[model samples]
Target: MTDKKMNFEVSKYDSEIAYLSFPAHPGKGKKGIVMKQKELSSLIEGYKGPEVYLDFDENGELIGMEILL
Candidate 1:
C-alpha cells in the first residue's frame, strides 16, 4: 500500500528508490525529493512516530506530505 510517508532524494538505481524521513530541520518542514519505491522502506527504517506517511505523484513529484504526529 502506497501510504503517506515523507521521503527524501538520496539516490537511485534501477527500480530502487532511496528515500528518507523527509529530512526536516528544527521547527521547519522537510527537504522533500523524488525517490524510487525500493528505497522507501530502508529510508523509513528505525524511526518513531505516530504513523508513517508519504505524498507523491505517478510522475514522481512531491505533491504533498504529512506526519501522523
Candidate 2:
C-alpha cells in the first residue's frame, strides 16, 4: 500500500475492523475505513512528531499492524 492516510478500525474496538474501500471490494470508494478519535490519537502518537503517513506490507503469517516511528 502507498503511504497515504488510509482508514482502519483498531482491533481493540468492538473486535471488528473495516478498511476503506475494504478488502471485500478494492478501490470502491474515496475512503475505506473511518478512524475513531482514540485510534487516530494512537496512530499519531506513534509518529512522535509532525503528521505524516505510514505504509506496511502483508506479512505471510499473521496480520500485522505497527506504530513504527
Candidate 3:
C-alpha cells in the first residue's frame, strides 16, 4: 500500500456505522469501510467480534474495516 494518510468518519445518523478510508487508493461506493471508496473484493469476519469486518482490495491488501455500533 502507498504511504498515504488514513481517515475516519462516522455516520451522522445516531452513529450507526463508521468508515476508515485510505486516501491513497480512493474507490467508488459506500457499503462499508472499503465500500466507502474502493470496490469490495472480499470480506473477512474479524476475530475480535462478529460486528467487525475486515475489508480487502482486489490485490488482497487490507483497505479498511467496518464496525457495527
Please name the candidate that would achieve the greatest TM-score relative to the true structure: 3
Query: Per-residue lDDT tens digits of candidate 2, residues 1-69?
Result: 644344455445544433332232223333523232123345555545432222222332212232312
User: All candidates' lDDT scores?
Assistant: 0.41, 0.34, 0.58
Better structure of 2 and 3 per lDDT = 3
| lDDT minimum window of 10 residues, candidate 3 | 33-42
Query: Residue-wise lDDT of candidate 3 within 1-69, one digit each (tens)?
Result: 666788787877758788675654365465443433322233443434426556676566677766676
Clashes of 2: 3
Question: Which of 1 and 3 is the better model by TM-score?
Answer: 3
Q: In terms of lDDT, which candidate is strongest?
A: 3
Q: Determine the backbone clash count of candidate 3.
A: 3
Ordered list by TM-score, greatest first = 3, 1, 2
Each candidate's root-mean-square deviation in Å? 13.5, 11.5, 6.1
Task: Tell me the lDDT of model 1 at 25.
Answer: 16
The C-alpha local distance difference test score for the whole of candidate 2 amounts to 0.34
